[model samples]
Target: ISLIKKEIETFISSYNKSLQQKDKNIKISDIKIQKNTLSLNINSQGIFRPHNALLQLKNSISKEFGKKHKLGVREIKINNYDIQFDLEKKPLKNVTIPFADVKFKEKQATISLNNIDEEFLQKNYIDRMINLVNEKVENQYYEGKGEFWKLIWESGEKKPIWTKDPTEEMTKLDWLKQGPTKGKWFFRPQATAILKTMEKIAVEEVLKPLRFQEIIESNLVPFDIWLKTGHLEGMPGEFYYISEPATRDVEKWERFVDLIKITKEVPLEELEKNISTPAAGICYAQCPVIYWSFKGKTISEKSLPVLVYDNTAVSGRYESGGRHGIERVDEFHR
Candidate 1:
């Protein structure tokens, strides 16, 4: 793992020198390696074009590693790429609808629009739309089996509380105000319902007609199992041990820590010596990831490079006060 890290560092150093010659002030912010794949997260400054920079980086990496290794760029931020929406012409007392002006730099487009009363719509129609969408999704996709879809409820086990200790008492509403938990309860229900409706439409309406196989469900597995499979780790957020029972085996814990140290450059030696002490919750997990092309049965040379995807929630201990609505959470479902 360290050797891989050193190779990546060396590649970046060489790439930076090349970029310097081209008068570009950009560098990689982070690098995530899993198996033979490398994901480079870049940070750019001063008129950097993401598409062009990515092409250059890919070329450099190809020159260094050849075709044996896979490389990708993640989270490329382009400066000053802004879009503006505006009303082109005002409506004359409901006689005519206004036109919307969509502008992106020198490019511009216009479209017809209708302005609706938000308060009246919310008071009269929002609930009805929500119910209709929910009903459609429940019957069509879930076959009216609501049990399969868990509602975000006030579970005392997962609630966010104000107290430093878990034993301390707090009101449900008070706990919600602490972070994005409020959004999970208030907004996620409607958002998830709408999302499910779209997904159902795509699968049933679109993909089924095209005869594509539908694998439209999530998997629930143990945390250790997820770690062992190398599905999630080492991008962001702090590590957390949910329960002693889940992580009580000292030998297994040490092995997991050492694996992370090798892959993620974490200081496992210090962490192992101070096992009983907390270290700002920075520890992460490392697992051996089986590539999609190699999963299950062996394939012939003619059937090469199969695609696979794994989507599920994974646990993390995020820094306190880092929560932003449902965008960032302790357990992210993606």
Candidate 2:
């Protein structure tokens, strides 16, 4: 069965040969497998067919093996990449009922792959190519400027009943002459971080249709991309992400502008230790900065707040054709 899936991939690649002839430069990369399933996305392809092409491949597998299976479901966005699949295996003896032989009911699609002969469709439809590629699509978007989202500060200050042991001995000094530079700690409530974080990588959706589509579309793989911006307590929401991208990876940034490259993942601990301590010999405690480390990504303050470091990751793919995506540990994490 695994071999069949791989073959389905080879078959799809072979099938896509005609796409290039049409002057369509569709590219597919990234291949993944999970128990009884496989998935990927699409990028750069003029035609969106990962979901559709794979189903045909799956249907072919079903016909040759006398097995019953069905197509998977998918969600497509601007790039048109999505998730798609087939039904689980079951015994043919269950065909005794009217809706008996149906292997699975995915998204309300009554699909039967293996036993339904193509010859039958031709016999009934008068030589017409009878294939049903169906999917439901919805458009949901948020309003913003050039950057999909924005982060702004609100008037959230530290609660009057502050809890964390804070410093407060108003040091009366001539430094007040510097005005804003004086140590005036305005207890800030967690302000929203603007699309502060992003993870790059080769397109994972490459696996989505690679197993079944003759022509894999999409040259880029995008997953769990994180976007954080500044926000205030009671102000109009400051930040929102179109997609809940996973954690960030440092390796991916070693080279941006490239998307097809692959990189090895390092332990969150190793990533943390690699930080080249203050080239200027300054710590957050001494410079009115923020110092913290958790999960993997670390933020060491200097003049401005910076990520400084990140650890958890999957594969860092980028859009530049060489490197991409951040290293992600879990679909959601630090």
Please list the C-alpha lDDT of all candidates, in the order they appear. Answer: 0.44, 0.31
Candidate 2, residue 319: CA error in Å? Answer: 53
Please provide, for model 2 over 184-240, each residue's C-alpha lDDT reduced to its tens digit, 9 standing for 90 to 100: 122222211211222121122433234321221221122211211111112123121
Each prediction's TM-score versus the true structure: 0.24, 0.19
Per-residue error (Å), model 1, residue 66: 47
Q: TM-score of model 1 relative to the true fold?
A: 0.24
Q: What is the C-alpha RMSD of each candidate to the true structure, in Å?
A: 23.5, 24.9
Best by TM-score: 1
Off by over 4 Å in 2: 3-6, 18-23, 47-51, 54-334
State the lDDT at 80 in candidate 2: 29
